[model samples]
Target: MEKRFISLIRFRVAKAQYLNMGLKFKKLLISFFSVFIILASFGLGNYFGKSQCKVCPPEEIDFSLFWEAYHNLQEKFVDKEKLDIQKMIYGAISGMVKSLEDPYTVFLKPEESKRFIEDVTGTFEGVGMEIGIRKGQLQVIAPLEGTPAQRVGLRAGDKILEINGTSTVDMIVEEAVNLIRGPKDTEVTLTILREGWEKPKEFKIVRDIVEVPSLKWEVKRPASGYPDIAYIKLYQFSEKASFDFSKAAIEIMESPCKKIILDLRNNPGGYLEVAQDISGWFLERGEIVVIEDFGGKKEQKIYKAQGPSQFLDYPIVILINAGSASGSEILAGALRDNRGILLIGEKSFGKGSVQELEKLKEGSSLKITVARWLTPKGELIADKGLEPDIEVEMTEEDYEAGRDPQLDKAIEVIKNL
Candidate 1:
C-alpha cells in the first residue's frame, strides 16, 4: 500500500462518492462516442449544433453543443502542431474542477501529484512555510520553527505579493506552494506585505529539508517573581505527537512544578487523532474532545477522550495566537471546555475544514474539501476562530526586543490561580 499522509487538515471524500463519479465519467465517455458515431453517419463533419441534437438524450441536451464545439476546435484550429490532445484533455478536466471556486479543492497534474507524494513522506526540500488564503489574499499561516522561512523572519499574517519575482495576485494556495518549494539549498525570493509596513519587503530564503519536531518542553524557573512552571510547546500534531507529548508529560509531572503552560502559538495543526490522544492525558475518559459535523443532516462524528488523566489535578493554561489552528484549536477548545483551562493570547487561525486527496487518471490527483470540524461546545471553527480567555497582543516592539507578553500573561494567570 502507498504511504499517504492523513492529517487533521487533510482527508478524502468517501469511496462511494468516488465510485459514483467514475460511473458518471464512463457515462460521459459513452455519450461522446455516441455523438461522434451519429455525426459521422450524417456526414455532419465539423458542423456546429445550432439547437438540441434529436439523437442525444434529453438529459444531455446541453452537452451535445459542447461536443460540437470540441470537434470544431479539433478540425478548424490553425495551430495543428501546437494542439496536443492530451494537454487539451487535461486542461479541460482542470478547468471543469477549477470552476468550483473552492481553494481547498484542487486538481494536481501528474508532476504536481508526484511532488505531493514526496511531501507526505515527512521530508521535503522547501522554505517550510505553511500558507493559506485569507480574505482573498495569499497569506502566510506560519513559518515552521527552525526552518529557513522562520530564520528569515517570515511572520504569520504576511500577505504574499510575489514569489521569485512572479506576482502572486489571485494565485491559489497550492500554486503558491509549488512555486515556493524547491531543491534544498536553492534560494527563492518572496515579496511580502505585512501590517504596519510601508511597502512590500523581499526576502531571499534558501530551501532545506524540513523535519518538524512534534513537541518541545522545559521547566522555566521562577520568572518575573513567579513560581516555576512546566512549559510545553506543541509544534504540530504529527504522527509521533502522542508519544512525544507523553514523554514531555512524564518529565513535567516529575518536576517540582504544579502549574503547566501549553504553548500552541504558531502551530499550524496536523492530525485530529493526535490531538485527541494528547487531550486524553488531561481529560477524563469519554469526555467529548471535538465534533465532526458532516453537513446536510449527515450523522455527526464525536471524538471522545481515551484518558489516563495523569494531569487532572494540575492547573493548566493554553497559549495560542493567530498561527494556532485546526488540531491546535481542537485541543485548546477541548481542554478549555472540559477541564476549565484558560487560553491566553490572540485569536487563533480558523481552519476547520477537512480535505481528502484522490488519485485521478494519468497520475493526476484531486484534493476536495469534504467536511468541517466543530469544537466540543458546538462552536464553528471554520471562519470564526477561538477567542482567547485572556487576549494579549504581541506587538512589533515585542518581536524586535524579544519580549513575550502572551507567555508572561499566562504565567501571571497560572500563578494567581
Candidate 2:
C-alpha cells in the first residue's frame, strides 16, 4: 500500500512539470510575433514618411550639383584657412536672393537687420534720406524734410554715382545707404547726377539724429481776396501719423479754413496701416483705400476706409513729387480715385510693393516683396507711378531761391475749387 501511494505522488509531479514547459513555449511564440509586427509597422511608416515629406526636393530638380560643388570646395580648394563656413553660407543665400532680381527682397545679416528696424521706428543717426534701386542704378527716393539730406540739397530721382569717393556702380541700395550713413556730426560726401546737370556734383552732408515728423498744419490767409486754405504738410505716414493728423484735423475743423492743401512732397512712406487710418479722414466709410494683389496666386486683400470722414466734403488738393512714395502714393491714389480730388505737382515715386519682413535664425531677416499695390481703380503703383493732374516742374533755381511752384499751384487750384 505504501509503494502504490509513492508512485501516485510521482505521477502528479510529472504532469505539473509538463504543463509548465508548454506555458513557457506559448509565451515565447507570443513575444516573437509582437516584435515581428512592430518591426513591420516601423518599416512601412518609414517608407510612407519619405514619400510624404513636405521639404523633399521635387523629382525634376537634382540637388546633387549643389552637393557636388560643396564637396569639391571642401576637398579640393586650396587656402583652407580663408574658407569660412558661416560666411560661405551667407554668401550663398545672398546670391540666391539676388538672382531673383527683386531689389526690395533681400537677406539681412544680424547688424543690417537691426539698422532696418531703427529706420522704420522713426529715429536713427544718419543723413536722413530714403534710397532705392531704379533701372539697375542707385537713386535717391526722398530726402526727409528738415533733415541734413534736404538741407544739403539731396533731391529725389538723383542718381547716386559715388559715396565718399567709393564708386556705386553695381552697388545695391543697402550698400549705398551703409556708405552714406555715419555717426552723428560726421560728414559723408555723395556724388549725385540730376537730369539737367552737366556733370555729377558732390554734396557733403553731416549726419544727425533724425526725428521724423508726421504732419504740420497752418491756415493760409492769402491776400484777403481768397478764402483761408488749411495747408497740411504730411512728412511721413509714421507710427505717430494718425494721432498727429487727428489733432491737426481737429484744429483745422475749428479754424475758418474752408479748403485744404495736402502737401505730400518729399514724403517717403511709412506703415500701410497709418496710411489707411489717415485716408479715413478724407474718404467715406467702406470706400476702398488700397488693394494688395498677390498675382492671383492668393485672394486679393482690399483695404477700405474706416472713417471719421471729416474732410469728405472739404475741397482738397494733394501735392506730390518724385519724392512722394509708398503710403503717400496710396493715399494720393485713394483720394483722387474716390473724391475726384486733384493731385498737383510732379509724378509720384513708384514704390508701392508690399514687403513682408520674415525673421530668420541667428537674428537675421529676409525682407521679401510679397505683393504689388493697386489703387482702388486698379491702377498699378509699382514701377509705374501716379501722374499728377497739373504737371509742374521744380527747377534747381526754384529750390535754391526757396520758392515752391508746386505749393503755389496747389493753393491756386484749391481756391478755385
**Candidate 2: tens digits of C-alpha lDDT, residues 256-281:** 99899999988989889999999999
Query: Each prediction's Cα lDDT score?
Result: 0.86, 0.90
lDDT string for model 1 (37-60, tens) is 997966654343424454445553
RMSD of each: 20.0, 8.5
Residue-level error in angstroms, candidate 1, position 324: 1.0
Show where candidate 1 strays beyond 4 Å: 1-61, 68-72, 75-82, 223-226
RMSD of 1: 20.0
lDDT at position 186, candidate 1:
93
